[model samples]
Target: MDTFVWRDDYSVGYTPIDEQHQELFKRINAFGNALWEGQGKELLAAHLRFLADYVVSHFQTEEGLMTTHKFPLYEVHKPVHDAFVQEVSSVLNRIADAGLDTATAILVFEKSCDWTRAHVRGMDQELGRFLGAQRNSTAA
Candidate 1:
């Protein structure tokens, strides 16, 4: 599997969010490397646990920012975060049930990372635009 790389286009125009996304990319890439080297079975569960926790924290940060700024679509955007948390929680549950299998590792990465990539480009970018405009407007 190719390492997940952060591209310039993924920038949400927010430093905190962008930095967090880069950290996510690093974690995913690390997991991918461990999986490809056949060490995933031992570390997959731990890696996933850490990833899940970090994701929740990151989501909370985004939500808090949106709420603080009074982002118009915060209500709509929050559910996406809720859904993603549920999805990742389910994956964690599966790992707890069946243990770390290569198939699960591969599948999880493809789905989770793909969703994250699309999210940055979609909803997050929109949020970025709003927040950036808010900052600029207030600065003037």
Candidate 2:
């Protein structure tokens, strides 16, 4: 499995958001590591729960900032967040409820990592650019 590493380019121009993103990666990486180590359900579940819960909190922070700043693309962007939350929530729930076999565990890690990389590179980078432009304009 490809590990999630925080890259300098991943910064979204905001310190808090960037920090949270790094933390998100950290949590995901921990989850992957636990799974790879063949850790038992309790350990894996703890990491998965952390990922799910942190993601929800992080989304709230981003959405709040977008709303406060009146980000032009917020309406378009928010649904992405909602969908991700639902997806991750379902994965976490499935693990919690029915327990995950080896295959399912790997699937969860792959899905989380793939989605995160794409979203950060695409929609999130756009938001970061918008925020940066807004800052520059206000400074001028």
Per-model TM against the reference = 0.94, 0.92
Predictions: Cα RMSD each: 1.4, 1.7
- Positional deviation of residue 36's Cα in model 1 after best superposition, in angstroms: 0.9
What's model 1's lDDT at 84?
90
What is the RMSD, in Å, between candidate 1 and the native fold over all Cα? 1.4
Write one digit per residue (lDDT tens) for candidate 1, span 1-140: 55788899999998999999888888877777777887756588777878888899999999999999999999999999999999989888877856679988999888878999999999999999999999999999
Best by TM-score: 1
Model 1: per-residue Cα lDDT at residue 21: 89
Point out where model 2 deviates above 4 Å. none
Candidate 2, which ten residues in sequence have the lowest lDDT sum?
93-102
Colliding residue pairs in candidate 1:
none
